[model samples]
Target: MPAHRPRGAQRLHGTLPAARVAARATSPQAGGSGSATAGSGCVHSRRSIQVVAFRGERVAGRISSGDIEALRERADLASVIGDYTGLKRAGTRYKGLCPLHEERTPSFTVDPARGLWHCFGCGEGGDAYKFLEKVEALTFPEAVERLARLTGYELTYEDMSPGQRKALGRRTRLTDLVGEAARFFHQHLFTDDGSAARTYLKQRGLDREAAEHFQLGWAPDRWDGLVRHLTNAGFGQAELVDAGVATRGQRGLLDRFRGRLIFPIFDASGRDVLGFGGRVLPDRPPTTAPRDGEPPKYINSPESEIYVKSKVLYGLNWARAEAQRRDTVLVVEGYMDVIALHRADVRNAVATCGTALTAEHFRQLEKFARRVVLALDADDAGFAAADRARALAEEAGVREVAVLPLPPGEDPADLAASGAERVEEALADVRTAIEFQITHLLRTANTSTPEGQVEAYRRTFPLLARIGDRVLRYRYIRDIVAPVVKLSADRIEAELDAADQEPSSSTAVEVAAAPRPSEPRDPQLRLERQVLQLALQRPDLLPPSWSKVGEHDFTSPASRQLFVALAAAPSGGLDDVLEALPDEDTRRRVRALALADLPTSDSAHAAQVIDALRRAAIDREMAEVRARMDTQREQLSTDERRSLAARIEELRRRRDAIRDGHEGG
Candidate 1:
């Protein structure tokens, strides 16, 4: 028999055997007639039970319920939520545009008092943990762990052996190792052996302060320097290899990065170190040759358990808050560009990690800002790359994409080194993605000849056809394409129509048209919403006469259900009311009402709402009575006819009395 488990033992994802065994160990039946036999290596005692938990076929650990609750109580919902969106105070809550969806109005709201949030536009609503899970695309346990770390709350695990616990924590251990490796390299950057790398950085216009702020480091020009240093610091060779810092050579483990200046890449939170990017110094003495011959100018960490090249953006850790503040993100070509831009006070800049921009990268960028400006070089190759990126951004559903026009030979880093104002000026002169494409085609084409104009038109037709809005597409054709191509607007339109009708045109980029704003709702429904909003924001102002109103008085089923839930909710328990709501649609409606602006004179407004509801109810009854009289007049008896007529008259009188400010029964 096993010993009794302690209180607050949590149950995470697990198999049935683990669950049953854990229950038996904790239940009062232990050591009695109903006691269950323990499995292999299981130890049961009167006060403690030691067992392993399995999620599917893999070993898993659990977080205590008490710790999760403690984390929730300590975590500030507004602070965590405000990271992805700009929030302004609205009465007792905070309001912002929905980061999860495209909307012109502010429909996303946070109720700090209850630790809840909901977006009326997209219908995304949740507590802090759910919000993190949705925004970060993390699993439930990962969300909990992330929030716990942010709040500085330590968590305890249960129902796992030592081996299981270590296996579950492998990612954290590898991340810590990478962090230590970053520190080691950073310290080496200032040593006597690192003078060449230091000189190289200075020549690139980066001072010691900028280097330190970006945590720039130097990889010593040796095979086993980092390998031996990390091994001596209590990390195993396998761990170092797993962290992408060391590789297995014929002589044994060798440092992956050598004779280069290192740039540490961090997660978006700027806390966990994910990987490193290294730039080779031109003036350094030649080291041993590699088996693959001459090395490239730049080398980045290989993908491992913690890092994926396509999903990460360099400098995002430092640029997240600034991007949210400015509502734009400037993407450049290299780490130096990102560092240089930030040094020049263009703080919301990030770059890809030795790769081209990807759809995943654009999706991540959309979380922080609606607009993305590409600041790559203005050369031919850079223009081609920018076009590809614009297509990807559109496919990712990004709201706005533009490109900054730099000088013919200058990139962002070059401009920054020249002067801060130069970079700022270039940023302000950015053009829309379509405009840039059009301008590039015209400038590069030899428009003096008929062949050149036809070639330019052939290239520009696809770009125009990709525009989702018909009016916008036609405007571009009339204003730019017609003049440049030296063709009539009708000819271009016919060409576009012919291209669109072809089956082969499916390969062209498809842009989703923007959604039209919703029209105003019916006035009677608006009255019902106002009543519910009052109940949510200032229930104290609800008149005693409101008690006479039943669910049938409300025309909308959602409104009726919400009213019932609000009535049943305990005093001062808004959270309970939200929890009791039937579905997400109702909940979204409720949140919108709760966060909407209320009238200044709530007391008098409350009375007006009550009177309107009563008169509306009377009106509905009279309509039904008149409807019945007309429909059933031929078959109805004389008494039924008289009764229906009298009912309609009574309803009319009641409605008039209520409108006249006299209470009518």
Candidate 2:
């Protein structure tokens, strides 16, 4: 959960007061479901009901149900979910492998009609906010704030009470501080004190336009320059520290960035600054000597409340649209490589921040493009990095991974320095990830004899085996594998057969729609689930007898809880009932049941199902009585035995009546 900040005392660097800012009502941008309009309101917390008195339109400052609904209306759920996983149309809904869980087949589904999703495989389900909460690990308020930004809606809390505002103010302030710090660093780069940093940029072949475009900055040699500037601007030292701009020192608070070139890090939205990546000057005596606490080459801000290194890509803010447009994203090594690529016209480049290519990073990029081109150096370290990248990409289920072959002794930054056209030309001839792996191995293998050829094949066959597509895998075997090993394509194909290795297609894998591994095996539990599933799927078909069904009649604990929530719903809508559920997991189950395809709504079939559950309930009660009698037979007095016998008989009668298809009630 993100830390909560209160308003008023919470000061962000650039955010203006709600009272001073005008509410500009605009339509939702492209890729959204639609515009947030007035009158549509929704309440998130349990026990909260739809109150029509307040409107979603800009009020004095308090957030309204209408405002939330309007935001919800504008966010397209399928499109948002698609950003996290590959979704293919499945009837009116969309289905994809759940990013929330590991599975061979896709069971995650998104209903564009309702702007909701549910995964039958993992039983995770929710609307946009809930999806964001689970996928991004965001709190409710944070999710709301993100949606508001995505929809380009201006939010105000003037109508909210002071206490409520205070609770929400800290986050606002931290974000503001980062934004202010970015501006300060950028402005400082042009000042007289930034002469050395400016010269460094020039030597790298970067110009003024490049610096401003990438929001490049320079931190002065002194410690308190940024500290004093931010504090004088009404931000406290504590706030600066919290935002990762400053660190606690022996004396007091000290700036985290000093005597370095700064690159502001932003989240994918490109709106708020999350942290900074700083590069030490080349000419300066290393501040990161063995005795010094600094790193020798580069240092990024420590992970804080807002900046999560694994989840962020350095140039994503500027490169996402271009990556999507080109259907490819270029993965680079450093901030300068990304900036240099962008400086040349290769805009679809992003870098990992002082970290290895993580599975999460690949998952994030997989959403943008079907293919990823790793633009790494052509050195031993680069080859190792490429191999690690290939493994992570495979783990994340990325469709294609290609390695950009750079000239020996050159990096992307070095190549980009020449011209954009040269970079583009190099990109034109790229090797598939498998080909790169094979080439890498052959270069190391002593393939001067039959034994050497066999060794090379032994190493390369595993790489080809990992390729998911059968056709593509064989193509690589024929085109690249057979010639290298001095064998016909049939011989290599026979080797694959002898090895019993088969390629796995990501799209072909299927997770059967049956009882989930976690589902209860008790017969009555299935009955309870079936009844709830029907009612959830076709709530309108709920007969008047639904009022007679009680939570105690269900055997499954989760099912009983959902039954009570559904029976208590005022609107009888799935969303309304979902909002009323007691906990998130239970709500997720309800959503899964609601979204599942089940028997059609029919009064007769519903009655039969209801009666079956009633019979099961009576049998359960009778079994309990019989068990009591068997255990306490010797201990019971005459009167007690008689009473137990009578109770058993009563339950038996009820069970028999329900078994006969008569209404026990």
Candidate 3:
């Protein structure tokens, strides 16, 4: 009835007193097998409750409270997080910059007393297990085991016997198998049969050290080579298949990679070898025309339990620490590019594993560096990819995105092969996201005629509009676009706004659902916008004194909602706080703040601005109350009229108090 539960299945529940749990478990119908008896060997089979019993009460299926509580009690959340992020003591709490997203100041906090951590910037919050789950992308069981090992707390599961427990740790077993397979391939690469692969690497500028460093391998053309090695080493066929190293062919289970050069892909930590990227060998004296039905130049391990192509970066295991040290990361498109860049001494380099760049990739990179340089080919498709990636990075709150300028038909590998200085020069010529996008548009468009200029405008303006900062958007229109297109800033601004209003293909549904952007031309609304801008752009600079700038100070409904959100998160990222707001207008308003240049106001200047805004807001409220009193005076009863007068007097007094306070300060 309960889905034919497994013999060792466990139903996790809250803590219970030993006596009470045992009493309930020994009750009638708490069925068990073998020599298990009531009281001494009680087992609550239906509810899956387990109880400690006497030695004489033998049972077929075993259940116990085990060492779960011990595991939880021994885990130190602060120490666990401190390993990943540098933390400083903040009273009972520890604080550090959030690793989930880019931020200038620390907003991630850990409360050792409560065994919990939360990121004010990214809204990621959880206990130690959750922290590991997010940081390492580990599953719940994997996290538990990892922490258990760290704390030296051995966990015992009630639902699993010793044999099953050993077998149930499937991921660990698969990971070990993959690691061994990588070693086997590496060993194979150096044998007599691997001469051609060695030649290929040498020709590509990858020396012996480079190949060994990357753990380059050769998968023999014969299918049985890897199969025989792993089998003799005691790995089963199913385990090999699960690891994505072997496939079931018509003849039998065979190695997935055959007669190809192999590059092992690891997780960010460098311990787990998730999968492999294999490149096909080049033909001798290549034909003039390409052969039909030939496999693509490269093939990657299929999506498996251990490997998700989008989640694995080729060189991240090595690049993470280097990126952090350098404060920048280079994201390339291929494994060779990553290796070549590293050989050139550009150590902070990683590449996607045969997939398009994803937001997850950016998130992972953001943990190591604020800046990401996209090292892509000098072609239309490559530029388009770079533009898309830059847009994604901006949306993800990455501080800066740059594109490396390479020569025609060359990638980072080619450039590095020429000379390390050439690679350095190319890196030096990296262009900012918008600049690169503009260059891309100009390159693709025919700029010889007036219509071509219009085409460029059409292609580039939407990207410019994507910028959150209104001031910076206007600056771009005035400074960059005007001279080239010979169009007035006013005309360009009008068109940019018009183009921005067009619904994006990806976010059409969200655009329709979200409120239209507010017009902030009114002086009061402009101040309100500035307040929100400061909250987003310089969260660290926002002082506790500005708590006086409440929702009432914002005249616009959208502004009022945003103010409330910001007030709740005085030192939180706009993106994190925005997620809590129910109103679509407020969400849209906050996103707009992200693109805009931050207002250049220090804490003192901001305090004065807040004081002035509060005074104006009070005056506005009092004026409304006074008008209401004047309009309703005749129709109101005597008591009602008295109430109105009292309200108006109170409003005036509050307004006077604000003015007095400002003047005194």
Candidate 4:
């Protein structure tokens, strides 16, 4: 996960406070809360402070308490969260795979009535604003402001000059600038200056509709074309440079992309424009071409406040909904492949931005779908890339990873250009990551000679041994490996056993290191967890005497903190407890406890659990007393020693009494 930082930290270079205020005033809210209604007033449920300034002097009035409450009421949380992960109705709540972590079962839940969401697996729970803050890495104010815009609830800055408002809002000015730049390039695409780019697109089989749908653009050959246009639009040179659309040149500011076709990269929501990717034109005149050494085929925006190249995937904004629907994402290698696939109605496809597939990219993909299929060209490079991607998928804990086999030298774009059915047919017959690896090995190996067959077996045996499922391993050895190596299944099994016995082989190491499910090591910790779970799920069943159990009674710090908050929480006020927690980790613990399913418990069972906690606490206290007595034995006076002995006796009696009560119950 990206480290959390304030949105203001991403301000444009040389931007003044006044400019920031203005940008905030004009910037659209980060996201919407719900349907928009025109009204004025503060709702005041959970107020998050927003600090704005007037004439460089700090002030506090931009986001009123009422506006936040109103936005909360208007925000459709499930809809907003659904944009990140798929959710399904589960009784009164909604459940889905947790977006924060990888898991098979649906442990993430949203309760619209309480305006809260929690993950039982990861223990992350919060309201809509908290949800946005964690998922998007936005600050609280940014989250609230985003939802405010989405719900059309206008946020007002009080007692500020218009300039001040503009300055505060300038925090979002860079995002707006990038968006404006996209429009500038897009508007130029249809002009005569873009004729070369248009011809290029046509040759690639992309018509005007495709261009318009993708908001494709063309950069003119002029050095300062974009610079002049943006400067004329009231933006500063530093702002333009900071936005990653222009660079400092010897003479003056120069357009970063010139004489190339442009593709705008948007955020996952397809709302905010992050940056751009430009491809060099094929027929550009030498005089208008790049003055720098040899022109690279492609150029992308430099890393900026809004865009992290490794973290962003091209075409994800358009592909998210379809990817979620299909439970798969087709990852290709270029912008044209994504566009081409979408044009062919294969909408669940995205591409990396002029880089190799990254762990961050895979992490983002996991949130949308369970499976990822690499749709690269079926050349040697594609096969090798797939091999690397499969390792990353394993590390990211993606449920299923596959490779789409295209014609030996063709990619998805080529297939799509030929016909939609060609691309669709290839997708239908994808290979699992393991199968692709075995096939690639076989294709590269000389299997006709006895020596070649032995070499193949040596290479393939380790791969087969790594399979955790015994049945699957045997099936692969029987169906795929045995025929290729001309080895019997029994012989293969014997070889695997011999390899397992070898201490130095990589196969032996991997097999020995296979992960095993861990059991809770501490019984007392388990008892504490049970007590807390009962408190969260069946509070009414808790005996009145259990109220006497304080936070100190629980040994684990997390459990202690949660117990304190739970005790102080009002009836049906789980959100209040969550808000009172000190940090995200503790809050996650509380949410997980609340969402966990506990066995059926009667009042007696609840009492027994609470009694067990009391006994444990007593034992802990007794141990402490005994340790102190031993450490200070010579230093203690007779009276002090007698007092310590009495204390220990009392604790023992209390423990025995609790045990007796449990037995009676």
- Any runs in candidate 4 off by more than 4 Å, and if so which? 1-171, 291-294, 504-665
For residues 313-418, write the lDDT of model 1, one tens digit per residue. Answer: 9998678657876789998878888998998889899988876678889998998899999874454554566656765786688899998877876778898998
Candidate 4 lDDT, 506-624, residue by residue in tens: 23332322122221223445567878888888889998668678888986767888888887777646888888789998888678778876645677677767776787688767755
Error of 3 at 36 (Å): 47
Angstrom error at residue 521, model 3: 17
Off by over 4 Å in 2: 1-154, 157-167, 286-295, 378-380, 395-397, 501-665
- Runs off by more than 4 Å, candidate 3: 1-168, 284-292, 488-491, 494-516, 519-665
TM-score of each: 0.56, 0.55, 0.53, 0.57
Candidate 2 Cα RMSD after full superposition onto the native fold (Å):
23.5
The per-model lDDT (C-alpha) reads 0.70, 0.67, 0.65, 0.70
Candidate achieving the largest TM-score: 4
Give the alpha carbon lDDT tens digit for every residue of 322-382 in model 3.
6876779998778888898889888899988877677777877887799998875555545
What's the true lDDT of residue 250 in model 4? 88
Q: How many backbone clashes does candidate 1 have?
A: 3
Provide the lDDT at 411 for model 1.
72
